[model samples]
Target: MDDAASIDGDTTRPLSQAELDALTDQLIDKLKTVFDPEIPVDIYELGLVYKVDVSDDKDVAIDMTLTAPGCPVAGDMPGWVEQAVMEIPGVRSCKVDLVFDPPWDPSRMSDEAKLQLNMF
Candidate 1:
Protein backbone atom coordinates (compact mmCIF):
# COMPACT_ATOMS: atom_id res chain seq x y z
CA MET A 1 0.00 0.00 0.00
CA ASP A 2 1.04 3.57 -0.66
CA ASP A 3 2.27 5.69 2.21
CA ALA A 4 -0.58 8.16 1.82
CA ALA A 5 -3.23 5.67 2.83
CA SER A 6 -4.15 5.20 6.44
CA ILE A 7 -4.43 1.80 8.12
CA ASP A 8 -8.17 2.23 8.26
CA GLY A 9 -8.22 2.67 4.48
CA ASP A 10 -8.75 6.41 4.59
CA THR A 11 -6.87 8.55 2.13
CA THR A 12 -5.14 11.60 3.45
CA ARG A 13 -4.47 14.85 1.65
CA PRO A 14 -2.21 14.50 -1.32
CA LEU A 15 1.38 15.66 -1.07
CA SER A 16 4.03 16.37 -3.64
CA GLN A 17 6.73 13.77 -4.17
CA ALA A 18 9.29 16.12 -2.69
CA GLU A 19 7.14 16.64 0.39
CA LEU A 20 6.74 12.92 0.86
CA ASP A 21 10.45 12.37 0.52
CA ALA A 22 11.19 15.02 3.13
CA LEU A 23 8.70 13.53 5.58
CA THR A 24 10.12 10.09 5.03
CA ASP A 25 13.59 11.40 5.81
CA GLN A 26 12.39 13.04 8.96
CA LEU A 27 10.64 9.86 10.06
CA ILE A 28 13.79 7.87 9.47
CA ASP A 29 15.82 10.25 11.58
CA LYS A 30 13.36 9.86 14.42
CA LEU A 31 13.43 6.11 14.04
CA LYS A 32 17.21 6.14 14.37
CA THR A 33 16.86 7.35 17.95
CA VAL A 34 15.23 4.07 19.03
CA PHE A 35 17.46 1.23 20.13
CA ASP A 36 17.04 -2.35 21.16
CA PRO A 37 17.62 -2.74 24.88
CA GLU A 38 20.07 -5.59 24.39
CA ILE A 39 21.76 -4.22 21.30
CA PRO A 40 24.01 -1.20 21.15
CA VAL A 41 23.00 -0.23 17.62
CA ASP A 42 19.96 1.81 16.74
CA ILE A 43 17.03 -0.14 15.36
CA TYR A 44 17.29 1.44 11.91
CA GLU A 45 20.86 0.41 11.32
CA LEU A 46 20.18 -2.92 13.02
CA GLY A 47 17.54 -3.64 10.39
CA LEU A 48 14.67 -3.96 12.85
CA VAL A 49 12.61 -1.53 10.81
CA TYR A 50 11.09 -3.28 7.83
CA LYS A 51 8.97 -0.48 6.42
CA VAL A 52 7.72 3.02 7.15
CA ASP A 53 4.63 4.71 5.82
CA VAL A 54 3.60 8.32 6.17
CA SER A 55 0.38 9.98 5.16
CA ASP A 56 -0.25 13.51 3.97
CA ASP A 57 -1.98 14.13 7.27
CA LYS A 58 1.38 13.41 8.85
CA ASP A 59 0.36 10.15 10.45
CA VAL A 60 3.13 7.54 10.46
CA ALA A 61 2.98 3.76 10.36
CA ILE A 62 5.91 1.45 10.81
CA ASP A 63 6.50 -2.25 10.35
CA MET A 64 9.27 -3.56 12.56
CA THR A 65 10.64 -6.70 14.15
CA LEU A 66 12.81 -7.66 17.07
CA THR A 67 16.12 -9.46 17.16
CA ALA A 68 14.30 -12.39 18.64
CA PRO A 69 10.72 -13.30 19.50
CA GLY A 70 11.82 -13.95 23.04
CA CYS A 71 13.55 -10.63 23.43
CA PRO A 72 12.69 -8.98 26.73
CA VAL A 73 11.39 -5.77 25.21
CA ALA A 74 9.02 -7.38 22.76
CA GLY A 75 6.01 -5.75 24.37
CA ASP A 76 7.55 -2.34 24.80
CA MET A 77 9.62 -1.68 21.70
CA PRO A 78 6.67 -0.86 19.50
CA GLY A 79 5.53 1.72 21.98
CA TRP A 80 9.00 3.18 22.00
CA VAL A 81 8.99 3.50 18.24
CA GLU A 82 5.52 5.05 18.22
CA GLN A 83 6.46 7.58 20.85
CA ALA A 84 9.63 8.56 19.05
CA VAL A 85 7.84 9.07 15.77
CA MET A 86 4.93 10.92 17.36
CA GLU A 87 7.31 13.35 19.00
CA ILE A 88 8.33 14.73 15.64
CA PRO A 89 6.82 18.08 14.75
CA GLY A 90 3.88 17.94 12.32
CA VAL A 91 3.23 14.28 13.00
CA ARG A 92 -0.48 13.76 13.60
CA SER A 93 -0.07 10.22 14.94
CA CYS A 94 2.22 7.22 14.91
CA LYS A 95 1.52 3.50 14.88
CA VAL A 96 4.00 0.64 14.96
CA ASP A 97 3.18 -2.88 13.89
CA LEU A 98 5.39 -5.71 15.06
CA VAL A 99 5.81 -8.46 12.52
CA PHE A 100 7.62 -11.79 12.64
CA ASP A 101 6.96 -13.16 9.24
CA PRO A 102 10.23 -13.30 7.31
CA PRO A 103 11.78 -13.17 10.75
CA TRP A 104 14.75 -11.01 11.54
CA ASP A 105 18.25 -12.24 10.78
CA PRO A 106 21.72 -10.94 11.51
CA SER A 107 22.31 -10.60 7.79
CA ARG A 108 19.69 -7.86 7.76
CA MET A 109 21.94 -5.53 9.70
CA SER A 110 23.53 -2.65 7.88
CA ASP A 111 27.30 -2.55 7.52
CA GLU A 112 27.45 0.21 10.11
CA ALA A 113 25.54 -1.94 12.56
CA LYS A 114 27.80 -4.89 11.86
CA LEU A 115 30.89 -2.78 12.35
CA GLN A 116 29.55 -1.41 15.62
CA LEU A 117 28.95 -4.94 16.88
CA ASN A 118 32.25 -6.21 15.47
CA MET A 119 30.35 -8.66 13.27
CA PHE A 120 32.65 -7.92 10.32
Candidate 2:
Protein backbone atom coordinates (compact mmCIF):
# COMPACT_ATOMS: atom_id res chain seq x y z
CA MET A 1 0.00 0.00 0.00
CA ASP A 2 1.10 3.59 -0.67
CA ASP A 3 2.08 5.85 2.20
CA ALA A 4 -1.00 8.05 1.98
CA ALA A 5 -3.23 4.98 1.85
CA SER A 6 -1.40 3.51 4.81
CA ILE A 7 -1.99 6.66 6.76
CA ASP A 8 -5.70 7.00 5.96
CA GLY A 9 -6.58 3.41 5.00
CA ASP A 10 -7.63 4.51 1.51
CA THR A 11 -5.60 6.20 -1.18
CA THR A 12 -8.64 7.41 -3.08
CA ARG A 13 -10.07 9.28 -0.11
CA PRO A 14 -8.19 12.40 -1.20
CA LEU A 15 -6.75 14.87 1.26
CA SER A 16 -9.57 16.63 3.03
CA GLN A 17 -9.76 20.43 3.24
CA ALA A 18 -8.61 20.23 6.84
CA GLU A 19 -5.73 17.97 5.92
CA LEU A 20 -4.59 20.34 3.18
CA ASP A 21 -4.74 23.30 5.53
CA ALA A 22 -2.85 21.36 8.16
CA LEU A 23 -0.23 20.43 5.65
CA THR A 24 0.14 24.06 4.58
CA ASP A 25 0.48 25.10 8.20
CA GLN A 26 3.10 22.42 8.72
CA LEU A 27 5.06 23.69 5.75
CA ILE A 28 4.92 27.24 7.07
CA ASP A 29 6.20 26.13 10.43
CA LYS A 30 9.12 24.41 8.76
CA LEU A 31 9.79 27.60 6.77
CA LYS A 32 10.03 29.50 10.04
CA THR A 33 13.00 27.33 10.94
CA VAL A 34 14.95 28.71 7.97
CA PHE A 35 16.97 31.92 8.09
CA ASP A 36 18.81 34.01 5.51
CA PRO A 37 22.09 33.39 7.32
CA GLU A 38 22.56 37.17 7.47
CA ILE A 39 19.26 37.95 9.16
CA PRO A 40 18.47 37.01 12.72
CA VAL A 41 14.76 36.61 11.98
CA ASP A 42 13.15 33.81 10.04
CA ILE A 43 12.14 34.67 6.45
CA TYR A 44 8.44 34.37 7.26
CA GLU A 45 8.54 36.95 10.04
CA LEU A 46 10.61 39.15 7.81
CA GLY A 47 7.74 39.24 5.34
CA LEU A 48 9.65 37.33 2.74
CA VAL A 49 6.97 34.76 1.99
CA TYR A 50 4.17 36.23 -0.10
CA LYS A 51 2.26 33.09 -1.02
CA VAL A 52 2.18 29.31 -0.65
CA ASP A 53 0.28 26.99 -2.95
CA VAL A 54 -0.16 23.28 -2.38
CA SER A 55 -1.61 21.19 -5.16
CA ASP A 56 -3.70 18.06 -4.53
CA ASP A 57 -0.71 16.06 -5.71
CA LYS A 58 1.33 17.23 -2.71
CA ASP A 59 3.47 19.77 -4.57
CA VAL A 60 4.26 23.05 -2.83
CA ALA A 61 5.08 26.34 -4.55
CA ILE A 62 6.20 29.40 -2.62
CA ASP A 63 6.40 33.01 -3.73
CA MET A 64 8.85 35.08 -1.74
CA THR A 65 11.34 37.93 -1.79
CA LEU A 66 14.47 39.17 -0.14
CA THR A 67 15.28 42.30 1.80
CA ALA A 68 17.21 43.64 -1.13
CA PRO A 69 17.54 42.79 -4.77
CA GLY A 70 21.30 42.77 -4.43
CA CYS A 71 21.35 40.84 -1.20
CA PRO A 72 24.46 38.65 -1.30
CA VAL A 73 22.51 35.52 -0.42
CA ALA A 74 20.12 35.87 -3.35
CA GLY A 75 21.53 32.77 -4.96
CA ASP A 76 21.03 30.65 -1.89
CA MET A 77 17.84 31.99 -0.28
CA PRO A 78 15.48 30.19 -2.62
CA GLY A 79 17.32 26.95 -2.07
CA TRP A 80 16.93 27.37 1.67
CA VAL A 81 13.20 27.92 1.31
CA GLU A 82 12.83 24.89 -0.96
CA GLN A 83 14.73 22.72 1.48
CA ALA A 84 12.63 23.82 4.43
CA VAL A 85 9.33 23.38 2.63
CA MET A 86 10.37 19.94 1.43
CA GLU A 87 10.75 18.87 5.02
CA ILE A 88 6.98 19.02 5.47
CA PRO A 89 5.42 15.56 5.87
CA GLY A 90 3.23 15.40 2.76
CA VAL A 91 5.07 17.57 0.26
CA ARG A 92 6.24 15.62 -2.78
CA SER A 93 7.98 18.55 -4.48
CA CYS A 94 8.82 22.16 -3.60
CA LYS A 95 9.43 25.28 -5.66
CA VAL A 96 10.30 28.83 -4.66
CA ASP A 97 9.43 31.81 -6.83
CA LEU A 98 11.40 34.97 -6.16
CA VAL A 99 9.44 38.16 -6.58
CA PHE A 100 10.20 41.84 -6.23
CA ASP A 101 6.89 43.40 -7.19
CA PRO A 102 6.10 45.48 -4.09
CA PRO A 103 9.61 45.46 -2.82
CA TRP A 104 10.58 44.75 0.79
CA ASP A 105 10.64 47.43 3.43
CA PRO A 106 10.59 47.82 7.20
CA SER A 107 6.80 47.93 7.07
CA ARG A 108 6.64 44.37 5.74
CA MET A 109 8.31 42.97 8.82
CA SER A 110 6.38 41.54 11.75
CA ASP A 111 6.30 43.22 15.15
CA GLU A 112 8.45 40.51 16.64
CA ALA A 113 10.94 40.83 13.84
CA LYS A 114 11.12 44.58 14.32
CA LEU A 115 11.72 44.09 18.02
CA GLN A 116 14.43 41.57 17.34
CA LEU A 117 16.22 44.02 15.09
CA ASN A 118 15.58 46.92 17.46
CA MET A 119 13.82 48.77 14.65
CA PHE A 120 11.33 50.31 17.04
Runs in model 2 with CA error above 4 Å?
1-14
Alpha carbon deviation, residue 23, candidate 2 (Å): 1.0
**Best TM-score among the predictions, by candidate number:** 1
For all candidates in order, the CA lDDT equals 0.89, 0.85
Cα lDDT over the full model 2: 0.85
- Tens-digit lDDT string for candidate 2 (1-120): 454533354354467899987997798798899886788999989999998887667888889999999999998989988888877776789999899988988899999999999999
TM-scores of all candidate predictions against the true structure:
0.87, 0.84
Top model number, lDDT? 1
Q: What is the number of backbone collisions in each predicted candidate, taken in the order shown?
A: 0, 0
Q: State candidate 1's TM-score.
A: 0.87
